[model samples]
Target: MIEGALGDLRNGVSRIAHNEKIEELQSEFSGDKPHLQHSKPLHLDPMFYEALDVLHYVEPTCLAAFLKLSQFMHRVEDVPNTKAYMESDRIIKWPPNRW
Candidate 1:
């Protein structure tokens, strides 16, 4: 689980870095305020879809790991308790009074 989580995080970070690189390249080529032609989205880019597939595979695992990590970190940092109020007794409060 730890390995999978790390792998997914690594992949996600790499993807973001790649995207930033692409954006930088585009900006370098097309100066400030590049004119984007309003046209239908290109459907021929299989790479785009392939990236999406990788994201789909990694997203859930990444999210779960992130949540776990966040909780862990929070515990380590001794974050304040923020839980909402709860009813005293679920069975007594939820059921009908007649019962």
Candidate 2:
């Protein structure tokens, strides 16, 4: 009985953590302005949804997977501009150039 109860608690925590990840992923692709994310609805990408399907099933509380996917999503989102920034060495510039 105690084992069953512990299992329930673990599942609950897992769902909550997964929910947070979903919300985070949603927020990642939400709006034009980063500051406007809160006002927008989720705009998750197909890749995110696909990855979620695989990860959530394997381990609902898989933080490591979430982080990896999150990082990839961030990179994917920034590719166009980020590529230029990287080639320009701005990413490594100390006292980052004034806008």
Candidate 3:
């Protein structure tokens, strides 16, 4: 459980026997943002909160859903526009550090 961030993977999980490659980082989330502007900020983009939500509760409703969602998430990372999406403030950028 990435605290449910990738819970879908668990659901879609199977005894089907297959092969896939997943890139798990040494840490669940990475990157460091340290700057003077970090002065106890009072506000953050709504997308930021949405990002956290996906990170918090993305478990699968079923095992099929889990496998499907995992492939979907993996595919999302493979899209040509992924770099752009990650840089932008879109829900697509959910799981900021993990993705």
Per-residue lDDT, model 3, residue 43, is: 30
| Candidate 3 structure, TM-score to reference | 0.25
Q: 12 in model 3: Cα distance from truth in Å?
A: 21
Give candidate 2's root-mean-square deviation (CA, Å).
Answer: 13.2
Model 3 clash pairs are: 11-63, 12-66, 12-67
TM-scores for candidates 1 onward, in order: 0.23, 0.25, 0.25
Ranking by lDDT: 2, 1, 3
lDDT of 2 by residue, 1-99 (tens): 868865765665466555855656445655344322333213444334334434455575664655545554455445565457657854653322220
lDDT of 2: 0.48
Clash pairs detected, candidate 2: none
Error of 1 at 52 (Å): 2.3
lDDT per residue for candidate 1 within 1-99, as digits (tens), equals 868866765775586445635444433543443121112223322233233334445463543433333333233223222112122233232221211
